[model samples]
Target: MPLGDSITGSPGCWRALLWQKLQKAGVNNTHFVGTLPAQGCGFTYDGANEGHGGYLATGIVSNNQLPGWLNQTHPDIVMMHLGTNDVWNNISPDKITTAFSTLIDQMRVSKSTMRILVAQIIPMAPSNCADCGNRVIALNKAIAAWAPTKNTTSSPITVVDCWTGFSATSDTIDGVHPNNSGNTKMANSWYQPLVDNIEALS
Candidate 1:
């Protein structure tokens, strides 16, 4: 499922672009499943996702929501791009990582073999929130370090760097949220990981 915050839920959200790209590439049997129906993206896709706009990592985990979603959807793979809101809210990176770990564990509890693609959230524009951008960088580093330890004999968590080439000034609408170009970049970033893990679905 396309899972995250507003980046995955917004109308022109990257999830739609990713879905559309995958469809065009012949991965037509896949479906985006989530408790929340897809909004925005102009009806371009099935619009199913777990992206809760403005949701914080702690809130998502504290509410114990992932387990229910995992049980209901039973998705073969989960694409996660969270923590933006947490950083925006000035939450500590350690807490953010803990929440993310909890989320991953919850998903594994539901399906041990499930594949998860965790994103290094995109850069924040200086005009919007400069300090948050640095936080995003540090968070991404922490997430990268966190992924290897998460690899299991069955499920392996892969980290996709959505921030490396993402230029906030050019690719975002409001520094944090991605625009069409940014979404396209995200879609491309997810392509290989999706392809590499597509076998999990089969």
Candidate 2:
């Protein structure tokens, strides 16, 4: 499941690149499963994903919805790139982290062995949300620190850093969402960790 916000759903978005890359690499057994389906990168690609535009982490968790989705999809892996909206909305760091942690716990309940790849959200145009960049940095740091502690002999959580070398000015459509180049970068970010963990899917 390519899970997140608009970044995961937009046409030709990172999720599309992820599908294209996987197909090119000949990984066929895997399917992009989600409760919601969206079209991006034209009609040539699988458009299924759990990405919801303009949804916050708190919103996703509070509705008691993720567990249902997890049970329904039964995905082997979940690629999550949330927290952009949380940071934009100026939600406190602790609350954001708590919400994220809760969501992960819910996922584990549904599929204890499921692999989850969480992302350090990409950069945003500072003008779009003041101190947004700083908040992202803080949240990513928190996420990075929090991830390793969750690792175990089984069902380890991996953190994919999507911020490094990512240029918001050049990569994003409005400093909040990725443009084509940004999408390609995002795709590559998702691909490496996925390939490294391919054994888990089998």
Q: State each candidate's clash count.
A: 3, 3
List model 2 lDDT by residue over 52-136, tens digit each. Answer: 8888888898887788888888887888999888899998777887898888888788788878899988988657587998888
How well does model 1 score by local distance difference test? 0.84
Off by over 4 Å in 2: none
Model 2 deviation from the true structure expressed as Cα RMSD, one decimal place: 1.5
Q: Which is the leading candidate under TM-score?
A: 2
Q: State the lDDT at 177 in candidate 2.
A: 85
How high a TM-score does candidate 1 get?
0.93
Give lDDT tens digits, candidate 1, residues 113-159. Answer: 87899988899854656688788888898898888877786888989
- Cα lDDT listed for each candidate: 0.84, 0.83
TM per model?
0.93, 0.94
Clashing pairs in 1: 11-40, 11-41, 38-47
